[model samples]
Target: MSIKPSRGKPLDVGAIGLGPDALPAMADTAAQSRFDFRAWWPEDRRELPYELEIGSGKGTFLVQQAQQMPDTNYLGIEYAGQFARYAADRLRRHNLNNVRMLAYDAAVFVEWFCPDASFRQVHIYFPDPWPKARHHKRRLIQTPLLRQLHRVLTPNGFVRIVTDHDDYYAWIEDHVAQVTDLFERQPFERPIGAGEGEVVGTNFERKYRREGRPFNALSLRKL
Candidate 1:
Protein backbone atom coordinates (compact mmCIF):
# COMPACT_ATOMS: atom_id res chain seq x y z
CA MET A 1 0.00 0.00 0.00
CA SER A 2 1.11 3.54 -0.81
CA ILE A 3 0.58 6.43 1.60
CA LYS A 4 0.79 9.95 0.24
CA PRO A 5 1.79 12.76 2.52
CA SER A 6 0.02 16.06 2.77
CA ARG A 7 1.85 19.17 1.57
CA GLY A 8 3.98 21.20 3.99
CA LYS A 9 3.07 19.11 7.00
CA PRO A 10 6.24 18.59 8.96
CA LEU A 11 5.86 15.49 11.10
CA ASP A 12 7.03 16.51 14.55
CA VAL A 13 6.67 13.36 16.64
CA GLY A 14 7.77 14.91 19.95
CA ALA A 15 5.03 17.48 19.56
CA ILE A 16 2.94 14.78 21.34
CA GLY A 17 5.73 12.97 23.27
CA LEU A 18 4.91 9.54 21.69
CA GLY A 19 7.99 7.35 21.88
CA PRO A 20 9.47 4.04 22.93
CA ASP A 21 8.47 2.65 26.38
CA ALA A 22 5.98 5.55 26.71
CA LEU A 23 8.21 7.06 29.38
CA PRO A 24 6.78 10.54 30.18
CA ALA A 25 4.55 13.63 30.02
CA MET A 26 0.72 18.86 30.48
CA ALA A 27 -1.79 21.76 32.38
CA ASP A 28 -4.19 23.91 34.34
CA THR A 29 -6.95 25.75 32.50
CA ALA A 30 -6.88 29.42 31.35
CA ALA A 31 -9.66 30.82 33.55
CA GLN A 32 -12.14 29.13 31.25
CA SER A 33 -12.70 26.36 33.77
CA ARG A 34 -13.96 28.93 36.34
CA PHE A 35 -11.27 27.61 38.70
CA ASP A 36 -7.55 27.90 39.33
CA PHE A 37 -6.59 24.97 37.11
CA ARG A 38 -2.80 25.08 37.32
CA ALA A 39 -2.34 24.72 41.05
CA TRP A 40 -3.17 21.01 41.44
CA TRP A 41 -0.56 19.13 39.38
CA PRO A 42 2.70 18.07 40.94
CA GLU A 43 5.92 19.83 40.00
CA ASP A 44 7.71 16.49 40.13
CA ARG A 45 5.47 13.83 38.56
CA ARG A 46 7.02 10.34 38.75
CA GLU A 47 4.28 7.67 38.75
CA LEU A 48 0.75 6.79 37.70
CA PRO A 49 -2.08 8.76 39.24
CA TYR A 50 -5.76 9.40 38.55
CA GLU A 51 -7.40 10.12 35.18
CA LEU A 52 -7.10 9.83 31.40
CA GLU A 53 -8.95 10.48 28.11
CA ILE A 54 -9.13 8.11 25.16
CA GLY A 55 -9.61 9.31 21.58
CA SER A 56 -8.79 12.81 22.74
CA GLY A 57 -10.12 14.74 19.74
CA LYS A 58 -8.46 18.15 19.52
CA GLY A 59 -7.67 17.79 23.23
CA THR A 60 -9.66 20.85 24.33
CA PHE A 61 -11.63 19.11 27.09
CA LEU A 62 -8.69 16.98 28.21
CA VAL A 63 -6.55 20.09 28.44
CA GLN A 64 -9.17 21.90 30.45
CA GLN A 65 -9.66 19.02 32.84
CA ALA A 66 -5.92 18.56 33.28
CA GLN A 67 -5.61 22.22 34.08
CA GLN A 68 -8.54 22.37 36.46
CA MET A 69 -7.64 19.18 38.28
CA PRO A 70 -3.88 19.09 38.45
CA ASP A 71 -3.78 16.61 41.31
CA THR A 72 -4.85 13.85 38.92
CA ASN A 73 -2.58 12.78 36.06
CA TYR A 74 -4.03 12.77 32.51
CA LEU A 75 -3.17 10.73 29.44
CA GLY A 76 -4.70 10.89 25.96
CA ILE A 77 -4.72 8.05 23.43
CA GLU A 78 -5.44 8.98 19.84
CA TYR A 79 -4.65 7.24 16.57
CA ALA A 80 -4.90 9.95 13.98
CA GLY A 81 -1.45 11.38 13.31
CA GLN A 82 -2.42 15.00 12.64
CA PHE A 83 -4.93 15.22 15.48
CA ALA A 84 -2.44 13.69 17.87
CA ARG A 85 0.06 16.34 16.85
CA TYR A 86 -2.57 19.02 17.16
CA ALA A 87 -3.46 17.83 20.69
CA ALA A 88 0.21 17.83 21.63
CA ASP A 89 0.66 21.27 20.11
CA ARG A 90 -2.25 22.63 22.11
CA LEU A 91 -0.72 21.32 25.34
CA ARG A 92 2.69 22.74 24.46
CA ARG A 93 1.31 26.06 23.24
CA HIS A 94 -0.50 26.35 26.52
CA ASN A 95 2.66 25.45 28.48
CA LEU A 96 0.95 22.53 30.24
CA ASN A 97 3.15 19.85 31.81
CA ASN A 98 0.55 17.62 33.42
CA VAL A 99 -0.71 15.50 30.54
CA ARG A 100 0.78 12.85 28.23
CA MET A 101 -0.61 11.55 24.91
CA LEU A 102 -0.02 8.56 22.63
CA ALA A 103 -1.16 7.50 19.16
CA TYR A 104 -2.03 3.86 19.80
CA ASP A 105 -5.10 1.68 20.01
CA ALA A 106 -6.84 1.70 23.36
CA ALA A 107 -7.11 -2.09 23.29
CA VAL A 108 -3.39 -2.50 22.67
CA PHE A 109 -2.47 0.00 25.35
CA VAL A 110 -4.96 -1.47 27.77
CA GLU A 111 -3.56 -4.92 27.09
CA TRP A 112 0.09 -3.84 27.34
CA PHE A 113 0.98 -0.37 28.63
CA CYS A 114 -1.39 0.45 31.50
CA PRO A 115 -0.77 -1.18 34.86
CA ASP A 116 -3.41 -2.93 36.96
CA ALA A 117 -5.76 -0.56 38.74
CA SER A 118 -3.80 2.33 37.33
CA PHE A 119 -6.50 4.74 36.25
CA ARG A 120 -9.38 6.16 38.21
CA GLN A 121 -11.18 7.33 35.10
CA VAL A 122 -11.28 6.26 31.44
CA HIS A 123 -12.78 8.55 28.84
CA ILE A 124 -14.09 7.18 25.54
CA TYR A 125 -15.58 10.08 23.71
CA PHE A 126 -17.27 9.84 20.33
CA PRO A 127 -15.71 6.52 19.43
CA ASP A 128 -16.45 5.04 16.07
CA PRO A 129 -19.78 3.28 16.52
CA TRP A 130 -19.16 0.97 13.57
CA PRO A 131 -22.88 0.94 12.85
CA LYS A 132 -22.95 -1.37 9.88
CA ALA A 133 -23.68 -5.00 10.62
CA ARG A 134 -20.42 -6.08 9.11
CA HIS A 135 -18.51 -3.42 11.03
CA HIS A 136 -20.31 -3.85 14.35
CA LYS A 137 -17.77 -6.41 15.45
CA ARG A 138 -15.03 -3.85 14.95
CA ARG A 139 -16.58 -1.27 17.24
CA LEU A 140 -14.43 -0.31 20.22
CA ILE A 141 -17.17 -0.93 22.78
CA GLN A 142 -17.22 -4.70 22.91
CA THR A 143 -16.95 -7.47 25.48
CA PRO A 144 -13.18 -7.60 25.16
CA LEU A 145 -12.89 -3.82 25.33
CA LEU A 146 -15.08 -3.69 28.39
CA ARG A 147 -13.03 -6.44 30.01
CA GLN A 148 -9.87 -4.46 29.36
CA LEU A 149 -11.50 -1.36 30.77
CA HIS A 150 -12.35 -3.27 33.91
CA ARG A 151 -8.87 -4.75 34.29
CA VAL A 152 -6.89 -1.53 33.89
CA LEU A 153 -9.23 0.58 35.95
CA THR A 154 -9.05 0.78 39.73
CA PRO A 155 -11.60 -1.10 41.83
CA ASN A 156 -14.06 1.72 41.38
CA GLY A 157 -12.66 3.04 38.16
CA PHE A 158 -15.17 4.50 35.76
CA VAL A 159 -15.50 4.27 31.97
CA ARG A 160 -17.39 7.00 30.23
CA ILE A 161 -18.81 6.27 26.81
CA VAL A 162 -20.20 8.96 24.55
CA THR A 163 -21.88 8.48 21.19
CA ASP A 164 -24.47 10.06 18.91
CA HIS A 165 -25.87 6.94 17.34
CA ASP A 166 -29.15 6.11 18.96
CA ASP A 167 -29.11 2.45 18.04
CA TYR A 168 -25.52 2.07 19.02
CA TYR A 169 -26.27 3.89 22.24
CA ALA A 170 -29.09 1.50 23.11
CA TRP A 171 -27.01 -1.45 22.12
CA ILE A 172 -24.24 -0.38 24.46
CA GLU A 173 -26.72 0.31 27.21
CA ASP A 174 -28.15 -3.17 26.85
CA HIS A 175 -24.78 -4.85 26.66
CA VAL A 176 -23.19 -3.17 29.64
CA ALA A 177 -26.34 -3.29 31.72
CA GLN A 178 -26.27 -7.05 31.32
CA VAL A 179 -22.77 -7.45 32.70
CA THR A 180 -23.20 -7.98 36.43
CA ASP A 181 -19.85 -7.16 37.99
CA LEU A 182 -17.99 -5.81 35.02
CA PHE A 183 -20.14 -2.70 34.72
CA GLU A 184 -23.01 -0.74 36.14
CA ARG A 185 -24.46 2.34 34.46
CA GLN A 186 -24.76 5.46 36.48
CA PRO A 187 -26.69 8.65 35.78
CA PHE A 188 -25.87 10.44 32.56
CA GLU A 189 -24.07 13.14 34.50
CA ARG A 190 -22.20 11.04 37.03
CA PRO A 191 -20.31 13.96 38.46
CA ILE A 192 -16.92 13.03 36.99
CA GLY A 193 -17.93 9.52 36.08
CA ALA A 194 -18.71 10.13 32.39
CA GLY A 195 -21.48 12.00 30.67
CA GLU A 196 -22.45 12.31 27.00
CA GLY A 197 -18.81 12.87 26.11
CA GLU A 198 -19.85 16.48 25.48
CA VAL A 199 -20.03 17.57 21.86
CA VAL A 200 -18.24 20.84 22.31
CA GLY A 201 -17.09 21.57 18.79
CA THR A 202 -14.10 19.28 18.50
CA ASN A 203 -14.07 19.61 14.65
CA PHE A 204 -15.73 16.18 14.51
CA GLU A 205 -18.42 16.19 17.20
CA ARG A 206 -19.62 19.54 15.92
CA LYS A 207 -20.47 18.04 12.56
CA TYR A 208 -22.50 15.31 14.23
CA ARG A 209 -24.19 17.53 16.77
CA ARG A 210 -25.15 20.25 14.32
CA GLU A 211 -27.14 17.73 12.34
CA GLY A 212 -29.50 17.42 15.31
CA ARG A 213 -28.25 13.96 16.09
CA PRO A 214 -29.32 12.46 19.36
CA PHE A 215 -26.18 12.06 21.41
CA ASN A 216 -25.91 9.59 24.28
CA ALA A 217 -23.33 9.47 27.05
CA LEU A 218 -22.92 7.19 30.06
CA SER A 219 -20.47 6.40 32.85
CA LEU A 220 -20.00 2.84 34.10
CA ARG A 221 -17.86 1.87 37.07
CA LYS A 222 -15.70 -1.23 37.51
CA LEU A 223 -17.09 -3.43 40.22
Candidate 2:
Protein backbone atom coordinates (compact mmCIF):
# COMPACT_ATOMS: atom_id res chain seq x y z
CA MET A 1 0.00 0.00 0.00
CA SER A 2 1.16 3.56 -0.69
CA ILE A 3 2.03 5.68 2.34
CA LYS A 4 -0.14 8.73 2.88
CA PRO A 5 0.89 12.29 3.75
CA SER A 6 0.40 13.30 7.37
CA ARG A 7 -0.61 16.43 9.26
CA GLY A 8 2.39 16.27 11.54
CA LYS A 9 4.74 19.27 11.75
CA PRO A 10 7.22 19.06 8.94
CA LEU A 11 10.92 19.49 9.66
CA ASP A 12 11.68 23.21 9.91
CA VAL A 13 14.46 24.26 7.54
CA GLY A 14 14.31 27.85 8.72
CA ALA A 15 15.34 27.08 12.29
CA ILE A 16 18.46 25.45 10.99
CA GLY A 17 19.87 28.74 9.59
CA LEU A 18 18.03 29.90 6.47
CA GLY A 19 16.40 33.31 6.60
CA PRO A 20 12.61 33.67 6.59
CA ASP A 21 12.58 35.32 3.17
CA ALA A 22 14.29 32.33 1.59
CA LEU A 23 11.33 30.08 2.34
CA PRO A 24 7.82 30.21 1.00
CA ALA A 25 5.22 32.12 3.03
CA MET A 26 3.05 29.03 3.40
CA ALA A 27 5.84 27.24 5.21
CA ASP A 28 5.96 30.04 7.76
CA THR A 29 2.18 30.00 8.27
CA ALA A 30 1.99 26.25 8.87
CA ALA A 31 -1.73 26.40 8.02
CA GLN A 32 -1.78 23.37 5.78
CA SER A 33 -3.37 20.25 7.21
CA ARG A 34 -0.96 17.95 5.42
CA PHE A 35 2.74 18.16 4.64
CA ASP A 36 2.32 18.36 0.88
CA PHE A 37 4.91 20.00 -1.38
CA ARG A 38 2.21 21.98 -3.18
CA ALA A 39 1.30 23.68 0.07
CA TRP A 40 4.93 24.47 0.94
CA TRP A 41 6.37 25.28 -2.48
CA PRO A 42 7.38 28.80 -3.36
CA GLU A 43 4.73 30.62 -5.37
CA ASP A 44 7.03 31.47 -8.24
CA ARG A 45 8.13 27.87 -8.64
CA ARG A 46 4.65 26.34 -8.53
CA GLU A 47 4.47 25.41 -12.21
CA LEU A 48 7.95 23.96 -12.58
CA PRO A 49 8.62 20.22 -12.55
CA TYR A 50 10.69 19.08 -9.55
CA GLU A 51 13.13 16.39 -8.46
CA LEU A 52 14.38 15.18 -5.08
CA GLU A 53 17.85 14.41 -3.90
CA ILE A 54 17.81 11.99 -0.98
CA GLY A 55 21.21 13.03 0.39
CA SER A 56 22.17 16.41 -0.96
CA GLY A 57 25.57 17.07 0.56
CA LYS A 58 26.77 20.69 0.29
CA GLY A 59 24.19 21.22 -2.50
CA THR A 60 26.77 20.48 -5.19
CA PHE A 61 24.53 18.30 -7.34
CA LEU A 62 21.48 20.54 -6.94
CA VAL A 63 23.43 23.71 -7.62
CA GLN A 64 24.99 22.31 -10.76
CA GLN A 65 21.93 20.51 -12.05
CA ALA A 66 19.48 23.27 -11.16
CA GLN A 67 21.68 25.74 -12.98
CA GLN A 68 21.69 23.47 -16.00
CA MET A 69 17.92 23.09 -15.91
CA PRO A 70 16.60 26.45 -14.79
CA ASP A 71 13.00 25.50 -15.45
CA THR A 72 13.06 22.54 -13.05
CA ASN A 73 12.62 22.68 -9.28
CA TYR A 74 14.78 20.72 -6.85
CA LEU A 75 14.43 19.71 -3.21
CA GLY A 76 17.33 18.31 -1.23
CA ILE A 77 16.97 16.39 2.02
CA GLU A 78 20.01 16.15 4.28
CA TYR A 79 20.03 14.47 7.68
CA ALA A 80 22.76 16.59 9.21
CA GLY A 81 21.60 20.01 10.32
CA GLN A 82 24.88 21.76 9.64
CA PHE A 83 25.24 20.33 6.15
CA ALA A 84 21.67 21.27 5.35
CA ARG A 85 22.32 24.82 6.46
CA TYR A 86 25.47 25.02 4.39
CA ALA A 87 23.70 23.59 1.36
CA ALA A 88 20.75 25.95 1.69
CA ASP A 89 23.18 28.83 2.03
CA ARG A 90 25.06 27.64 -1.01
CA LEU A 91 21.91 27.60 -3.12
CA ARG A 92 21.03 31.05 -1.87
CA ARG A 93 24.49 32.30 -2.79
CA HIS A 94 23.99 30.92 -6.25
CA ASN A 95 20.61 32.70 -6.40
CA LEU A 96 18.87 29.51 -7.37
CA ASN A 97 15.28 30.16 -6.33
CA ASN A 98 14.07 26.92 -7.83
CA VAL A 99 15.86 24.83 -5.22
CA ARG A 100 15.02 24.18 -1.56
CA MET A 101 16.86 22.35 1.21
CA LEU A 102 15.56 20.54 4.29
CA ALA A 103 17.38 19.15 7.25
CA TYR A 104 15.60 15.92 8.23
CA ASP A 105 15.68 12.17 8.08
CA ALA A 106 15.27 11.60 4.33
CA ALA A 107 13.65 8.21 4.71
CA VAL A 108 10.96 9.39 7.10
CA PHE A 109 10.28 12.57 5.12
CA VAL A 110 9.91 10.66 1.87
CA GLU A 111 7.71 7.90 3.27
CA TRP A 112 5.41 10.14 5.32
CA PHE A 113 5.37 13.66 3.92
CA CYS A 114 5.91 13.30 0.18
CA PRO A 115 2.94 13.37 -2.22
CA ASP A 116 2.50 10.39 -4.49
CA ALA A 117 3.73 10.64 -8.09
CA SER A 118 5.18 14.05 -7.41
CA PHE A 119 8.80 13.76 -8.46
CA ARG A 120 10.44 13.48 -11.86
CA GLN A 121 13.56 11.88 -10.41
CA VAL A 122 15.19 10.85 -7.12
CA HIS A 123 18.95 10.90 -6.58
CA ILE A 124 20.86 8.97 -3.91
CA TYR A 125 24.63 9.11 -3.90
CA PHE A 126 27.13 7.42 -1.60
CA PRO A 127 24.79 6.66 1.31
CA ASP A 128 26.44 5.39 4.47
CA PRO A 129 27.26 1.72 4.16
CA TRP A 130 26.85 0.94 7.88
CA PRO A 131 29.78 -1.44 7.54
CA LYS A 132 29.08 -3.28 10.74
CA ALA A 133 26.55 -6.08 10.39
CA ARG A 134 24.61 -4.99 13.47
CA HIS A 135 24.14 -1.52 12.03
CA HIS A 136 23.15 -2.70 8.56
CA LYS A 137 19.51 -2.35 9.53
CA ARG A 138 20.05 1.40 9.62
CA ARG A 139 21.02 1.60 5.94
CA LEU A 140 18.76 3.73 3.72
CA ILE A 141 18.15 1.33 0.80
CA GLN A 142 15.59 -1.20 2.00
CA THR A 143 12.24 -2.72 1.06
CA PRO A 144 9.98 -0.12 2.68
CA LEU A 145 12.09 2.73 1.36
CA LEU A 146 12.05 1.23 -2.12
CA ARG A 147 8.26 1.08 -2.01
CA GLN A 148 8.12 4.73 -1.00
CA LEU A 149 10.46 5.64 -3.84
CA HIS A 150 8.15 3.85 -6.22
CA ARG A 151 5.09 5.46 -4.72
CA VAL A 152 6.43 9.00 -4.93
CA LEU A 153 7.83 8.83 -8.47
CA THR A 154 5.89 9.97 -11.54
CA PRO A 155 4.81 7.38 -14.10
CA ASN A 156 7.87 8.13 -16.23
CA GLY A 157 10.22 8.93 -13.36
CA PHE A 158 13.24 6.91 -12.35
CA VAL A 159 15.74 6.62 -9.51
CA ARG A 160 19.51 7.12 -9.80
CA ILE A 161 21.91 5.66 -7.27
CA VAL A 162 25.68 5.73 -6.87
CA THR A 163 27.73 4.14 -4.10
CA ASP A 164 31.34 3.25 -3.34
CA HIS A 165 30.85 0.57 -0.72
CA ASP A 166 30.95 -2.89 -2.25
CA ASP A 167 29.14 -4.64 0.58
CA TYR A 168 26.43 -1.98 0.70
CA TYR A 169 26.06 -2.18 -3.07
CA ALA A 170 25.28 -5.88 -2.64
CA TRP A 171 22.74 -5.03 0.02
CA ILE A 172 21.12 -2.45 -2.24
CA GLU A 173 20.99 -5.01 -5.02
CA ASP A 174 19.29 -7.53 -2.75
CA HIS A 175 16.67 -4.97 -1.72
CA VAL A 176 16.13 -3.99 -5.35
CA ALA A 177 15.57 -7.64 -6.12
CA GLN A 178 12.77 -7.72 -3.56
CA VAL A 179 10.99 -4.90 -5.39
CA THR A 180 11.25 -6.20 -8.96
CA ASP A 181 7.51 -5.79 -9.35
CA LEU A 182 7.80 -2.07 -8.59
CA PHE A 183 11.03 -1.18 -10.41
CA GLU A 184 13.04 -2.33 -13.38
CA ARG A 185 16.80 -1.95 -12.97
CA GLN A 186 18.58 -0.12 -15.76
CA PRO A 187 22.02 1.29 -16.59
CA PHE A 188 22.96 4.50 -14.80
CA GLU A 189 24.11 7.44 -16.86
CA ARG A 190 26.19 10.22 -15.33
CA PRO A 191 24.31 13.42 -14.79
CA ILE A 192 25.26 16.39 -16.95
CA GLY A 193 28.33 18.36 -15.73
CA ALA A 194 29.80 15.35 -13.91
CA GLY A 195 33.54 15.08 -14.36
CA GLU A 196 34.96 12.80 -17.01
CA GLY A 197 35.19 9.77 -14.75
CA GLU A 198 32.78 10.72 -11.97
CA VAL A 199 29.30 9.27 -11.65
CA VAL A 200 27.39 12.14 -10.01
CA GLY A 201 30.14 14.61 -9.07
CA THR A 202 29.07 15.06 -5.45
CA ASN A 203 31.62 15.88 -2.76
CA PHE A 204 31.66 12.33 -1.44
CA GLU A 205 32.19 10.91 -4.93
CA ARG A 206 35.11 13.25 -5.63
CA LYS A 207 36.71 12.46 -2.27
CA TYR A 208 36.24 8.72 -2.74
CA ARG A 209 37.55 8.87 -6.28
CA ARG A 210 40.75 10.55 -5.06
CA GLU A 211 41.22 7.56 -2.79
CA GLY A 212 40.94 5.17 -5.77
CA ARG A 213 37.69 3.62 -4.69
CA PRO A 214 35.56 1.59 -7.07
CA PHE A 215 31.96 2.75 -7.48
CA ASN A 216 28.70 1.08 -8.44
CA ALA A 217 25.78 2.85 -10.07
CA LEU A 218 22.36 1.95 -11.51
CA SER A 219 18.94 3.32 -12.34
CA LEU A 220 15.48 1.97 -11.50
CA ARG A 221 12.56 2.96 -13.70
CA LYS A 222 9.14 2.85 -12.02
CA LEU A 223 7.44 -0.31 -13.22
> For each candidate, what is the lDDT?
0.66, 0.78
Q: Model 1 — which ten-residue stretch has the worst lDDT?
A: 24-33
Encode model 2's per-residue lDDT on 1-223: one tens digit a residue: 1211224433233422333233333433223312556534667778778798987877788888888888887888887766777777667767777777877777867765676888989999988889999999999998999998898899968999999999999999999999999999888888885867778899888888899998999899998
TM-score computed on alpha carbons, candidate 1: 0.76
TM-scores, all candidates, are 0.76, 0.84
**How many backbone clashes can be found in candidate 2?**
0
How high is the lDDT of residue 22 in model 2?
35
- Model 2's TM-score against the true structure: 0.84
Candidate 2 — what's its lDDT? 0.78
Report the C-alpha lDDT of model 1 over 8-64, residue by residue, as the tens digit. 455343444463344321113212212211123445663546676778867766766
Candidate 2 Cα outliers beyond 4 Å, as residue runs? 1-34
